[model samples]
Target: MASVQPKTRTFAGVALIDTPLVNAALQHARAIHDDMSFNHIHRSWVFGALIASKLPNFAAVDLEVHAVSAILHDLAWDYKSTFSTPDKRFEVDGANAAREFLGREAPDWDSRKRQLVWDAIALHTTSSIAKHKEPEVALCHFGIFADFIGPAFPGGIISKAAFSAVIEELPRLDFKEGVKQILCNLCKHKPETTYDSFAREFGIRFVDGYEVPSELERILNALDATAEV
Candidate 1:
């Protein structure tokens, strides 16, 4: 049987893929995430997609994978959500959620597509790794950085009008404080999850009892068998 091509939705020069899978992913995100997070994820997808749409490797990007990954990038931000876990990193939670979502809602996506979504969401925050991974992962990272870093992001490749449109629609009300609040809450409650990641800094600066184990201390006495670097 012939495969159906995904639909492309474009407006004012901005384009996004529209499929049942992507639509379901968006709805799932909207239902679970608060205004700030929902808007931020959408902004990430737009920034990433806009940038990808301009790139030479644009053809290599899996639009649906990128969409779902960005839409569910911060699944752990809500501790009460379906993706929440007591002992996993936030990114891991998001990744697992994305993978599970794909499996349940898009069985035709195949393992590779689901894996791409997993990697994209899993590594969105780990820039050093994500940028070196698949185009979907790298583009997801780029979109996220674009949202946070704005016009100064790396190459400033995305068009100005598109950038403006994304922010205007999302309307970043308290985005900064909203992020701060989540990070600090993790420090206060899931401090172990905050260690050895970007959230560590928030814990150090904001949470009273949060502490990172020294590398040397871990060398002498560690938490697990995993290598520490």
Candidate 2:
């Protein structure tokens, strides 16, 4: 579908890679996500981009891919969206859906570039791992982490002015409440998907009757089922 009136909301200056593909991706995210989730992801991108600007290594990084990845990082959080699957972890679901979006809308993007977006979205939650990946992947992770926590990054803090501007544009409206509801919804309906991911704790705490079998038990259960078959 043609992009609607530009919901891609990046900060002024700082050389944004304002392309149709990026705008389309942002627009798509705006359509499917709730206000809090939408604002969070955009904030993540802004935070990450600001960080990347300080590092000389990020010059070679593809900003379009990074923007798209950051914009749609939490796609499957809206579990009711068409992007979500019954059993896939939310990260994988979001990554797959992002690839699908690129395949359909930005056909000119090569497989490697599309996969870069997938890696960024899929690995956004894994700071330990995502940091070791390509620039796009690592930046997405850093951005999400910055927004989730405070913006006091490792090398230095993000500019206070920039942070304020982003927050002013995207006012966080009860972000924790919105996030808890989404996580609880995931646990309530797709408990299997939350079994080993970040949502597991949320499931245990928030979802009634949601069991997390220990690693040993999981292995034993598999082996026993195999023996029975």
Candidate 3:
């Protein structure tokens, strides 16, 4: 008998199943199976990487788990988005899928490591309720922050309302100081720069060009004030 070829899954203008597991997850999220695309996953990865770079003493193990989770975090959206707002259930579904896939394909990964991946996926989409005490949870929260910053392509605009929500949800810290530090680091590359610099460097071009919204503008202004003093 002749050998049979297995069918393949194509998504988001490309065949991503051949890609690495993390990349495949991103592609799956962005795939055209439904209304949402892998763009969201792509944005999450970009933002996650940037945040990971900035975090103090971020663990490589935690980062690896976060990368995997960020890509696969919304894999169940194709089914979940249809019924209701993509929420906790959606995350649980994705985590379950990730655990199953990882078990079959990455058997070398220990249970604890695999669980970290699942935990990251479960929490990445539920940042508001995430417990910062857990390193994986913090990494997941970082990925969510990346999503909010509009790192994804097309319609990656962070509206004032969205920014407000993030500020309210984010742990109370010296955000203005943090922004200033990030901005100062950014200015080293371009003397006259704005939020667009941050966006462009991280491949987060706004759909309508890189314009800082009013809320972000206020944040930037506060950062500038702190820097001047």
Candidate 4:
């Protein structure tokens, strides 16, 4: 008897690019994120597919989860986002939004799949960890980082031309300023939520009057207390 063959997913360097879900996710992201972030999401998915192509089980990867995670990773960057919640990390806001979107649009998805997408978006900012999580989570993190900082992929997985093509399709528009503005908004509008993430340090460095105790200050205080003993 012949062995069964697993289903293989095709890659087009775009997340659900030709599917209705792509349009839906794009529309949803456009309403919430600035053009920069919207482009980031697009490139993130494409870059993620680039990363996925090098994985051991590349053909078996779930494109739906990848598309949802990439498209919604930064959905909460804007305060006006329907997914934005006060006093929660930006990642959480994006994760919640992804969950809600799936519930409404892809209600047939099992809880396990939903949770995978949620983790992918929620943990995209966490380093060393997201890279080790499930495939969707890890790939989503890699995609976000690769888009922002060239293809810093392991073993130089993707070729320059491939990366360039994705960039041409989705140009990164004023991404630096967009990131700065989003960080400022998070600190200024939702100061409480920035505490546990890099946004906290960003607030201290960029946002006026937004002060958090420096790591050096904390170390010095610890040393002073030890000397008193």
Q: Candidate 2: misplaced stretches above 4 Å?
A: 1-14, 225-229
| Candidate 4 TM-score over all chains jointly | 0.82
Sorted on lDDT, best first, the list reads 2, 1, 4, 3
Candidate 1 per-residue lDDT over residues 1-229, each given as its tens digit: 9978779997436788988888898899899888889999988988888888778876777888888888889887766667878788888898998877777998776788888888888788889999899988898888998999777776658656667877887889899998998888877777777777898898888878788998788766654455453
Error of 4 at 82 (Å): 2.7
Model 1: which residue pairs collide?
none
TM-score of 2: 0.89
What lDDT does the true structure give each of the candidates? 0.83, 0.83, 0.51, 0.80
Error of 1 at 102 (Å): 1.1
TM-score for all models, in order of appearance: 0.91, 0.89, 0.48, 0.82
Predicted structure 3: lDDT: 0.51
Per-residue lDDT for 40-124 in model 3, tens only? Answer: 4554554555455455645443555666677776665443233212233445666887787688667787888888877777666
Clashes of each: 0, 0, 2, 0
Candidate that beats the other on lDDT, 2 or 4, i.e. the better one: 2
What's the C-alpha lDDT at position 157 in model 3?
41
Root-mean-square deviation (CA) per prediction: 3.1, 4.9, 17.6, 5.1
- Identify the leading candidate in terms of TM-score: 1
Question: Which of the two, 1 or 4, has more lDDT?
Answer: 1
